[model samples]
Structures are given as C-alpha cells and as structure tokens.
Target: MANNSLLEIKRSLEPHVGAKVLLRANGGRRKTIERTGVLEETYPSVFIVKLDQEQHAFKRVSYSYADILTESVEVTVCNDEGQVRIEYLQQ
Candidate 1:
C-alpha cells in the first residue's frame, strides 16, 4: 500500500514504533538533512523520532504527516529483516 491519505500513512507507521528509521528532510535551498533515529511515537497529527546521539546535534524531532504527503520529508525504516521505504501520496 502507498499509504496515500494522512490517516493511512499514520496507520501504516503505527506498527513500527521503536524501530530504527532514517529521515531525510529538506532544509531549504535544495539542502537535504539526514538523520537516523528510533521511531518514538505517533499521534493524531504528528509523529516523533528520537535521534541518535552520535550523529545528530538535536535530540528528537517531530514531524507532521502532512510533511510526508507534501514530499518534504522521507522516512525509511531499518530492521533486521529489511528496510521499509514507502512513498506517501496525498488523497
């Protein structure tokens, strides 16, 4: 499933809490910032990621599902089995 709608996207990510994920977010001027973290929590409007201390300056970041819908941020879940990289689309 592409997880197009915001509710669908949230539902899709709900099971992956506490898993490792790589986030690529646009920082402006074509800059893409990468961060690896644990999937902390998911709420009605946004989801939180706890950043790895070794690689990032800030501790944790929260992003809205809308960001995913707009393609401003990308999330890739890393697991022992494999990586789950799904592209989200807006309904």
Candidate 2:
C-alpha cells in the first residue's frame, strides 16, 4: 500500500487532467501526451484516464510510469467565479 493518502493523490491529480504530460515510451522514447481525463473507478489502484486526441479511455495503473509521470503535476484549485484562490502548487 502507498504511504500517501488517496485523497491527497486524488486532489493532486484532479486539475492536472487534460494537461500536458511527459511520457517515457518504450525504448527510451519521450513524447508529450495531454491528459484527457481521470477516473477513480476502482480503489487502491487503477485511475482511469483518457488520452487527448483519442477517444478510448485507459486504466492508468497506480505506482507505474503513468502515475510517476504525475509526480511533477501542478494543480490549482480555485473558488467559484474564478477569482478567489483556494489552493495551488509551485513545483
């Protein structure tokens, strides 16, 4: 089990979805993929995700490269009206 709380992970990954993500493909290839969406369909692992420019959704298994890629994720949770600030990240 991961030491981090699910809420924390969920909160961190929320706003970052549909944002650009750097993916390390097979054979050391690196490409940028825009995160289409996130789905916590199952617990403990498996956050459903859809890729930008694609329709099919994929299950991004937790703790894998997919998850690690979000390690650098930056999210900003704002209040209604898009004026009042709520939360955000610097790194």
Candidate 3:
C-alpha cells in the first residue's frame, strides 16, 4: 500500500517535469533553505531538482516524497500556464 501511494505521487509529478519549483526545507538547528529550480525528474523513491546556478557549477538535489509526507519539505510547482501546485505528503 505504501509503495502504491508513492507511485501515485510520482505520476502526479511527472507532468510537472521542467516546471519551475520552489523547494523549502528545514535544515538542522532551526535553519531553513529555499531553492528555486526546475523539476528535473521523478524516480520511484525520490525526485530531482536541477538547481539554478549563478556562480557555482550545476547541481541537482534529490528528496524523497516521504519528506513531504512527513512535512520535512515543501514543494511548490509552477506551470507554464501560471498555475501553481503545492504538494505535501500527509498521513
């Protein structure tokens, strides 16, 4: 059942590949980081975001959908048509 749910989330995100996204995550020690990137890919267990690099080399970050489900991360996807979708994994 758990695997099925993850699959569903993956499917929902597939269409948003290449869409702009804002990722907000809580680092340790009460610190948080927000990144803007393109939704690069969605794998079975995780999703990748290609970060917009200004001064450094290209970088990609991967986070499991479970992070959203656990509220450890928040993802906001903005489509080309000006539609925005926010996803958070819930129990």
TM-score on alpha carbons, each prediction: 0.90, 0.33, 0.81
Best by TM-score: 1
Pitting candidate 1 against candidate 2, the one with the higher TM-score is 1
Q: Candidate 3, overall lDDT?
A: 0.80
lDDT of 3 by residue, 49-88 (tens): 9999973265999999777766788888877677565564
Q: For model 1, what is the C-alpha lDDT against the true structure?
A: 0.89
Using TM-score as the measure, name the better of candidate 1 and candidate 3.
Answer: 1
Which parts of model 2 are misplaced by more than 4 Å? Answer: 5-7, 11-28, 38-42, 50-91
Q: Positional deviation of 50 in candidate 2, in angstroms?
A: 4.2
Backbone clashes under 3 angstroms, per model = 0, 0, 2
Point to the candidate with the largest lDDT: 1
Off by over 4 Å in 3: 55-58, 81-83, 88-91
lDDT of 1 at 35: 94
The best-first sequence of candidates by lDDT reads: 1, 3, 2
Write model 1 residue lDDT over 1-91, tens digit each, in one string: 3334888889888999999999999999989999999999999999999999998899999999888888898999999999998467533
Candidate 3 is scored at a TM of: 0.81
Residue-level lDDT tens digits of model 2 in 20-83: 3333223224643334333323344434333444543653523332244344332222334452
